[model samples]
Target: MRIFDVAEITRNIKEMCIEANYSLTEDMVSVIREAAKNEESPLGRRILNQLDENMKIAGEDQVPICQDTGMAVIFMDIGQEVHWEGGFLEDAIQEGVRQGYQEGFLRKSVVGDPFGRVNTGDNTPAVIHYQIVPGDSVRITVAPKGFGSENMSRIFMLKPADGVEGVKNAVISAVKDAGPNACPPVVVGVGIGGTFEKCALLAKRALTRPVDQRSGIASIRELEQELLEKINRTGIGPGGLGGTTTALAVNIETYPTHIAGLPVAVNMCCHVNRHAVRVL
Candidate 1:
């Protein structure tokens, strides 16, 4: 069995939080660059160009790409064969976030209470999703999700009879309603099947998938391509002014579900879909 220290987890998480806020993965950057080059509308092209420059500045200056900074969302894939040493794992994860926000000088956006509106001071107690998989390595993904696009996300509880067409319509309607609000040229993460909550998780997880890649499932890949085409055709443009490059990519994830239920969720993310991955 592989022996892992909780302190190491803290150190890595801290660095990841800072890194993710500073820059996006190469796949994401390339896609936006390609979009700007191919964009038909002059205004859309300009907006995409501005976006690229802003990202460049953020990385060069070691600053956040967007002011929101976002609440840290951690996905931990822990191996069953691994054994933890030192302090509690959960506390270490939270400490990592706390230290990252404090040391990184990132804006603190998380609140301790929903209605009270008190700041957490440090962005502690990140929304962590843990999964046990084969092997003895830990895979960590830190995704700082800003609220602008997240607020525009939607979930649909359709009948199994509603089928694929219904799913397409629901996602399209959500984007139409979102319009410029989701911070156009968004990457859409879609989850099909599973329970209500599971579907939402799936949608959020889908966003972490590399933007340049498609779902391995044949039907899902086709759906992803079709959705990307349809969304761009909406004329929402880059800054939502008007154009053909409304969305950068459409990623879909699926899971088995009950016969009576067809749960679908759309998790919207803006141009700065910030995330960083590391394995230990």
Candidate 2:
């Protein structure tokens, strides 16, 4: 078994936090460029251009692309054969977030209480999800979700009879209701066929997929394509200025669910779609 230092994990997470906020991934940049080409509205194309510019500036300056640097969401896949040689894994991850935000000058967005809404100055204590697999390496994905889009997320419990059409309609409605608020030219992640909470988790999981990657399931992929086309047709455009580029992509992740119930969740993300992954 290979033993990995916790300090290394901490440092990597810190770097990921900064890099993800500052740099727009290549796949995402390509999606924005392609969206600009296909955009029918002049304003939409302009918005896409501005987004591209924003990304370039952020990279060149080594700063966050958006003011709302977002809550630190970390996903970890730890190899069972690998042993952590340092302190608590979760604590190390949180420390990474704290140091990264401080060192990178990224905004601190996390709060201490839901109702009280006390600010956590350092953005410590990230929302961490962990899984164990068979290898000797650990893979971590950091996704910083801006509040604008995240606030508009939704979930619904559909009867099994609602079927595929129901799921599609729910997603469309969520996007429509979100309107310009969730930030147009967005990526829509749909989680289906799981328990209520699991559906939400899966929806967030869908957001981690590379922008150009297609779902493995043919039916789900077709659904994703259909949703993408329909959302863009809404003319929400970039920054909600009314154009043909309302959404850049739609991704769906699914799992088996109860026979009597069908749960669906939609997680919305802005064009920034900031995420980074590292393996050690």
Candidate 3:
């Protein structure tokens, strides 16, 4: 069995939190550059250029790419053979978030209550999801989600009769309705076939996949491509200005479900898709 020290985990998580907010991942940057090349609208190309500039400035200045630094959403794959030493794993993760945000100068956005909404100083308490997997390494992914795009997310349970076309239509409609609200040129993550809650989970999980990786399932892969084409065809462009690059990509993830239901969920991310991952 391998033992991982809590202090090392905390330190790595803190560094990841700060780095993720401050810099755009190279893969994401490459995808956006490619999208900008194919974008036909003059304004759309201009917007993409500005986004590139923004990312560059953020990195060079060591500042967050977006004003809303976002709530820290962490996903952990814990190896069964690895034992955590020194502290509770969750507390260590939260402490990492608190120190990262405080020292990085990232904005604090989490609230104590869903309704009363008291600011939770330090952004303590990250939203963490854990899964057990084989091996001795722990893999951590941190995705910081800003409110603009997250607020426009949606989930629906449709009859199985709705089928693939139904799922496609629902996603298209969701993006159409989201319109300017989701901050255009977004990444769309779709989860299908699971229970209502599982579908939502899948949708978020889809976001963890690399932007360029194609879905392994042929049908779902086709759907992802179609959705990407259709969403960009919406002309939502960057920051909602009219253009052909409304969405950079569409990702779909699926799982088996009951015979009677087709649950679908969509999670959106703005141009600044802030996420980082580490394996230890």
Candidate 4:
């Protein structure tokens, strides 16, 4: 078994927090560019261009792309053969977020409590998810999800007979309801099947995927394409100013579910789509 240092993990998470906030991923950038190219609305094309410029400026200036730095959400794929040393893994991750947000001068958006509503101060206690996989290496992805789009996300438990059409309608309805509130040119992550919580997680995970990549499953891939087309037809456009580029991409992730229940969750992400990764 390979032993890994917790300090190393913390250091990487710190960098990821800063970098993800300051830069937009290439995949997201490419999607925005293409969206701009195909956008029929003059205002939509302009908004997309401005968005690209904002990202470029953020990277060049080493500043956040948006004012809302967002809550730190991390996903870890830990190899069963790997052992962590130096300290508690969760603590290390939280420490990293605290340092990154503090040092980078990022906005501290996380609250200490759900109802009491007090600031976490340093965005500590990051939301982290782990999956055990086969190798000795560990892969961590830090995705800073903003609330504007996240709040617009929806989930539905449909009857098995509701089927594909139900999912399609739900997605369209969610996007339509979201409208300008989600900031438009959003990324839609649909999680089908699984339990309620699992489906929600799958949706969040889906947003971390590369915008241009499709599922390996042919049926799922086709559905993603179909959803993207239909979502764009909503004419939410960039900044919800009205255009054909309502969504930059539609990603779907599915899992086995109970025979009687069809659970679906949608996670919305704004144009920024900030995430970073490290592997060791």
The Cα local distance difference test for each model comes to: 0.94, 0.90, 0.89, 0.92
Q: Estimate each model's TM-score.
A: 0.99, 0.98, 0.98, 0.98
Candidate 4 lDDT over residue span 115-171, tens digit each? 988997998778999999998999999999899998999999999999999999999
Task: Candidate 2: count the clashes.
Answer: 1
**Model 2 lDDT per residue over 130-177, tens place:** 999999989999998898999889999999999998998999899988
Give stretches of model 2 more than 4 Å off: none
lDDT of 3 by residue, 11-105 (tens): 98899999899988887899888877888888888888888888899989988999899999999999999998899989899999999999999
TM-score comparison, 1 vs 3, better candidate: 1
lDDT of 4 at 201: 97
Number of the top-ranking candidate, with lDDT as the measure: 1
TM accuracy, model 2? 0.98
Between the candidate structures 3 and 4, which one is better when assessed by TM-score?
Answer: 4
Q: Predict model 3's lDDT versus the native.
A: 0.89
